[model samples]
Target: MAFTESSLLLPSVSGTNKNKNKVPEDKWYLAYIVYFTLGLGYLLPWNAFITAVDYFSFLYPDASVDRIFAVVYMIVGLVGISLIILYSHKSDAYVRINVGLALFVVSLLVVPLLDAFYIKGRVGFYSGFYVTAGAVGLSGVADALVQGSIVGSAGELPDRYMQAVIAGTAASGVLVSALRIFTKAVYPQDASGLQKSANLYFSVSIVIVFLCMVFYNMVHKLPVMKYYKELKVEAVTANEDNGPLTGPVWRSTVWNIVRRIRWYGFGIVLIYVVTLAIFPGYITEDVHSQILKDWYPILLIAGYNVFDLVGKCLTAVYLLQNAKVAIGGCIARLLFFPLFLGCLHGPKFFRTEIPVTILTCLLGLTNGYLTSALMILIPKIVMLQHAETAGIVSVLFLVFGLAAGSVIAWFWVI
Candidate 1:
């Protein structure tokens, strides 16, 4: 069914004028802020687990804590997202997001509860490591349920909401980095200090996840949200009347949507492949500085996170709006490979803290802007009825990138 601009502008209802129910206002931008908060909240659990890597490493001395976390989380998330894409038509976004939010609370609670009651600042507890990894996997599953739904839901709305969601993801990183820095400054560097910092991360994440649950439920009650959702329902109903969306028909429709957005998907995959190959793994494990000592990685991570937030927010002011240029920019990000490699094997100056830090910030900046561009562009390319599926499909491609990038991180970094 061809969904034209006029159809979306004036969806058929029982008895309403074409221009009677114009799109409702967001009213102080509450819906945008809620979406922003939802985006931030979903990633916070993953960040909490990753940001407390030092403590986890200290506890599980035998394991490659960072690499293992990345692999397990990304793989699990990839699988979960694939399943979400397959069964999206059978379910709904509202239920999926609520369930995912609850799961986030459960997964986040695991670490601190275990530490407080059982682990108790002890060492040589491989079992604890395994349990923690399981928690990470749970968070990954939660992320799949929540991230795709949030992005897909936003896809059905105006472009600004999508920008808010993408920017919120970057903000999550900045928030975690700030928490890491605060904990480092306040707590002593001993075991007690590490445990305290780790606990703080989980506690803060739990609070935010709960807030997201509240705000998310509150948002649907808003008039602006009702307006968009009503239009979506009308569009879907119109499409269904043409014929029942049988399995094969739906699959073919999904494939068509994929074909249209394949270039965007490729760019997203390449972006993460280059980024994950060099980041956190390289910054945290490979590099070292005599002056900054333990603080070097933290500073580098903070710089990257701050710049990422800047890049994501920039789209709000001036979106590129051109897919060709955005994809080319993603291709250009590959240069980071050589630049970062130089930090390891190039001249003395390239190996210094300054060059490495700048490259890392650039990596984040590019990652943020390019990802937001592709995501915002995907839904616009598809019909209204398929926009949600398109959003989920895009996220599935993104998870593939994350999974591949995580695996490569182990081998790509020196």
Candidate 2:
């Protein structure tokens, strides 16, 4: 059997091979604008968490603020997945995309407000959890919307949109990390004080996103709604071919795909969870201890972001274009088993902080390539059928990854 299920399902092999080249050159610019604007909104509050904790710890000395934030993030992710399934099934592409963008911008704006007012002066671990979780939970609404738009437009747009997303994430991570470093250097006291200054910074980010939303609405001349209409048509066509099935039958089919794909997605997710688990310990114990207090997190984050950016960019431009599903699957499987062993043995050999940090960075760099590869493979695995099911599978894999990391952390500590 051929590696790909069918050539007809493979999105255009080359940019020039697209069916309807209706995407205007101007639309490409709009896409970049969307990328940069939303990128800033997503990252600013995220990076701000580091600074916020510095301030919040002053009031609540015993709380593990980062852990609190992480737990809340997990919950928000679950809710977000639910929203994606519901909205993607019912809503048109344009409404879903626009509403998603709006919600995301609103979430960014709400973060500062929550911290500055409601959680201000509170002195407990859960305070950070509540504020961060509430902000991220709201943001999940936006994420679902964006993903719905992506699935709806999958075959319609160039691969550049996916590229832009990865690039934007990398850029945001780097830029926000740099900004935290700069703010610490110049306004050292303010960075650690009431967080009023950081609140101001996030407020500026919200404004930029709002402006971008307005611009996107104005310049989006293509019939974005029509994309979802077409998706519905495709679904109907598939149903007709397969013959009408009961709800239970459809459920069974989706579950079968989920089970088959779990190992593939889980492999990638495990790598990430291990990296995330190792990172905080290494940064706090090794990196911060060795380096200047202010420079440690910034440098590590900057390096991680740079490597991730390079990996994703290279994959998008080269690997994904020539991707064969079998090759992609083999690489994922090969890398995953070693990576898992590395995570298991790493703490034993690289017992020191510095060595562990290096290991973490390598893990990050390798995982970046794997992540980009996985995203590309996802569409091919499911083809156009049951895309929403595929998306749900991806999210569940990530959640499991987090859980696995958390469990490993407990064992390592013991």
The best candidate by lDDT is 1
Write the residue-wise lDDT of candidate 1 on 304-359 in tens digits: 99999898888788778778899999999989888888898899999899999999
lDDT of 2 by residue, 17-42 (tens): 35533423534466555644544444
Off by over 4 Å in 1: 1-17
Tell me how far the alpha carbon of residue 178 in candidate 1 is from the true structure, in angstroms, after superposition: 0.4
Q: TM-score for every candidate vs. truth?
A: 0.94, 0.73
Backbone atom clashes (below 3 Å) for every candidate: 0, 0
Evaluated at residue 327, the lDDT of candidate 1 is: 93
TM-score (C-alpha) between model 2 and the true structure:
0.73
